[model samples]
Target: MTSPLNTLPALEKTLQEVEILLAEAEGFDEDRKKLVVLNKAAFLLLVGKFEAYIENLVEEFVFAINSLELRAAHVPERLLAEHSVQIVKNVKDHLNNGKLEKVNSMFIDLSRYWAEIEPCNSLNISNKFSYGKHGEKELIKMFKRCGIESIFDEIVLYDPQEKYDSNEDSVLDIKGIFNSITNMRNNILHQDETPTLTVGNVKYYKNILVQLAECLEELLQKIISNADSKRQKEGMFDYVI
Candidate 1:
C-alpha cells in the first residue's frame, strides 16, 4: 500500500535505488578505485535531495496553515496588523468604504503584504528554527503568532525524549537531529566536503527522514481535517458567491 505520507513513495524509491547502487559499488575490487569515489558522490547527492525535500515539506506546511487562517478570517486587517503597521494602514485605506470591490482590492494588497512578512518564507527554516536560533521555542512562537499554535502543538510530533535505539538505548534528541542534518547539508554544499557514508549510516539517515516526513504528513492532514469539520459544524460553505 502507498504510505499515508504522500512524499514517502518517491523518497523511499530513490533511497532504495541509492542503496542498490552503493551495494554494487562495494562489489568492485580496489582495482576499480573510481567505483568507491562514485559511491561517495551518490551518497552526497542523496543527502542533498533529502535536505531539499525536508525544506520543501516545511514550506508547504507553513503555507497551508497561512492559507487556511487567511480563508477562515477574510479580514486582512486582523491578520496583517501584527506583522506591519504600514500594511495595516494600507489595508484600512483600501477597505475604508467596505464595498465588495474595495474588500477584494484590500485582499490583494494584503496578499502582497503577507508574502513579504511570512516568517518561514522570508527566512531559511534552519536559520529560523535551529537550536542557536529560536529552535522549538521559535516554532511555537510563530504558530501562536499565526493563531494556530493550539492545533499545531496538538498535531506535530516533536518528542525530544524519543529513543532512536532500544538495545543501545540511544535517545533521539529532536533539536540535535535537526541541527546536525542542517549542518551536514551546509557543510557539504559550502565546504565541498566528501563525507564518507557506510551502508549503516544511510539506513539510519533514511529512518530519520521517514519519521520526519510521516510527522509532517500527519500534521497537515489533521489540520485540514479539523478545519473542514469546523466549517461543517458552523454550517458554512468554503466560498460564497
Candidate 2:
C-alpha cells in the first residue's frame, strides 16, 4: 500500500546522495589540480538538487492540503463572493443569449458551469496561500497562512533565552534559517566566484535542509491527522442504509 510518509524516506535518500557527492567534491578540492572543476560542478549540482527538494516539499504540502476534505467555510468571504458573482454572471449570459431553446439543455449547461467553477475557485484559494520569501519575517507569514502560528507561543525552536519579540509573540526564527539557505542557493547560481564551496558549507546547509524537510513532514502529518479526526467526529464514514 502507498503511504503519504514516503516523502520522508525520499528526502532522506536525496540528502544521503548529496552528502556522498559533497564528500567526493571535497576530496577534489583538497587535491588542487586541474580536475578541481569537478568540485565546482558538484557544488552546482548540489544547489540545483537542494532547490528542487525545497520546491518539491512545497508542492507536496499543497497536495496534502488539497487532498483533505477541508471546509470551504474557512475561505475568505470576499473571494467566495467574487467567484459567486462570476458564476451568476455566467448563468446570466447564458440565459440572455437566447440559447435556452430547451429547458433540459439549460439545466445541463448550468450543472456544467457549476462543476467548472468549483475547482477553479478552490485552486484560486490555494494559489493565494504562499510559503513566503525565504526569511524569518516571511516564514512568520507562512506560519500564519498554515494557521499554526500560535503553536510557536509554547514551543520556541530558534532561541530559548531570547524573549519573543515579534509583533505577534513568536518564539521560532525559522524564517532566518530558510533565508540563509535561500541566500546560499542564490549565491551559487548567480555568483561567478569559482571554488568557493567547502565541504563544511555543504554539510551545514545539508543539515539545515534535512531539518526543514523533517519540520515540513511533521506539519503535513498534523494537518492530515487533524482532518481525519474532524471527519471521524462528523461520522463522515457512517454507513447509510
Candidate 3:
C-alpha cells in the first residue's frame, strides 16, 4: 500500500500488477477462457481500481484538511462558501419531501449549523450525486468541491517538458481518455455482453490511468497549499495564557 499522501505511487503499483497479469495470460494461450477472464474480471477490476484511486485520494485529501483541526474561519473562503451550499442542500432536502414544514425553526437551525460548522469533509462533496458516472465532468466537479476549479483545463496547460508520458510529446486528451475508459467500463458492467478486450487493450487502459494519475498527483498539490495557507498560524498569540 502506498501512503495516502502519495496517490500516484499507489495507483501505479496496482496498474503495474495488472499489466503483469495480462502479460502472463499470454503464455497460456491454449486456454481460451483466460481471454474471457481478462475481458470481464481484469477489465472490471481495472475500472474499479481507477475509481477507487479517485475517490480515495479525494477522501484522504478532505480528511487531511479536517485532521488539521482548522476552524471554519481558517479555511479557504471559496471552499467554505462552496460547502455552505451543501448546508443549504441539507436543509432543503428534508423540507421538499412532499410535506409541509415550518419556516421559522428551519431558519434557526440553518443559522446554528452555519455558526458551528467545521471544515467540510467527503460527505459534503458526495451529496446529491445519484449515479456515479465517474466521467470527466464528474471527476472535475469533484475537485471543484474542494475549490480547485477547472482541473482539466489546468491539465491542458501542462508543460510539454514535464509530460506524463516521457516518450510521447502529444497533448493529453484528458476528457477523451476518461470518456473512453468510462464508456468501456460502463458497457461491460451495465450490459450482459462479454466485451472484446485484449492484453493490449488492458495495457492501453492501464497506461492511460497511469498517465491520469500523474496529472492528478501534480495538480493535487494545490490542495495542500489550500490547507496550509488557510491555517491560522498566529492564533496562539491571541491566547490569554
Candidate 4:
C-alpha cells in the first residue's frame, strides 16, 4: 500500500527552499519576513504529516476490522449483520448510560502502556560507535512505519492535551516521547558517544522499543473496534431487519 506520507516530498522540498530563503535574508525587515516563512513552513509540515498520520490509522482500522469480520461465522449473512447491529447498539447504550468515562479511561490507560518503556534522552550505549552509524535511522523509520505513527495518533486522540484524572498514573508525555525518539535517531546519525550497552542503557532502549510496539498494537486494536462499531451503527443492520 502506498503510504500517505510518501506524497509530501514536494512540501518538504518547499520547506527546504523556505529555510534557504530565510538564511539568505539580510536586515531587520528581511529577518521578519524570514520568521513568517519559517512559521508557514512549520505549519505546512505539521498539517501534512498529521493528516497522513490519521489517514494511515484509519486504514489500519479498516484492515483489522474487516479481517475479524471475515473470520467470524454466522448462520446466514443477515445474521451477521444483526449481531453486528446489536453489538453496536449495546455499545451506544453503554456510552450514554454512564460508560463513556470508563471507555475513554480505558483507552487512556492503553495509551499509557507505552510509557512503561522509558526512552533514554541519549543512548549512552557503546561510546566508541554511534548507533546512527549502525543505521539507527533505519530502525527508527521501521518503528514508525511499522505502526508507531498510528499508535501516536491514538495516544493523541485519547489525550489531546496530555490531561488526565487527578489520580491517573503518569504516562510518557507524547511530546517527550516523540522528542526522545527523535533524539535517539539524531544521536545515531551524529555518531554521538552515548552510554554504551551498560545494564541501564540496554534495558532502557529495549523496554522503549517493546513498549512502543505493544502500545501500537493496542491502539490499532481499539481503532479496529471503533471502526467496526461505526459500520454497524451506519444502517448495515437494516439489511438484517
| C-alpha TM-score for every candidate | 0.54, 0.56, 0.69, 0.31
Model 3 has how many clashing residue pairs? 0
Ten contiguous residues with the weakest lDDT in model 1: 118-127
lDDT by residue (tens digit), candidate 4, 1-241: 1122232333344445434433443223445645444443333333333333334433453444334332222112232333334345556667888898765754443233223222111111111223323233333333343233333445532232345764345455554654554554445335543422222332243334334434544655554454455545542321211
Q: For model 4, what is the alpha-carbon lDDT of residue 142?
A: 30
**Native-structure RMSD, model 1:** 8.7
Q: What local lDDT score does residue 183 receive in model 2, on the 0 to 100 scale?
A: 70
Candidates' RMSD to native: 8.7, 8.2, 5.5, 19.6
Compared with the true structure, what per-residue lDDT tens digits does model 1 show for residues 134-157? 234544443343334433335323
Clashing pairs in 4: 124-194, 124-195, 124-196, 125-195, 125-196, 126-196, 132-188
**Evaluated with lDDT, which candidate comes out highest?**
3
Give candidate 1's whole-model lDDT: 0.50
What overall lDDT, based on C-alpha atoms, would model 3 receive against the true structure?
Answer: 0.63
Best by TM-score: 3
After superposing candidate 3 on the true structure, give the runs of residues whose Cα lies further than 4 Å from its correct spot. Answer: 1-4, 13-24, 69-74, 92-124, 127-132, 156-169, 194-196, 230-241
Looking at model 1, the pairs that clash are none
Q: What is the per-residue lDDT of model 2 for residues 1-241, given as tens digits with 9 covering 90 to 100?
A: 1136446677777666666766676666447653345555555565556555645654565556445433443332333344444445566676777656554454453344344322212322222324323444444444444445532342324333345655345444655655665575556556754545566666656655566656666765566566556655655332211
Q: What is the per-residue lDDT of model 3 for residues 1-241, given as tens digits with 9 covering 90 to 100?
A: 1123677777877766676667767776788887677656767788788877888777666666655555555555555666657656666666776433554555554454345443333224452223755687888777777667877777752323344754445666768877877787777777766667877777667776767776776666566655566554434222211
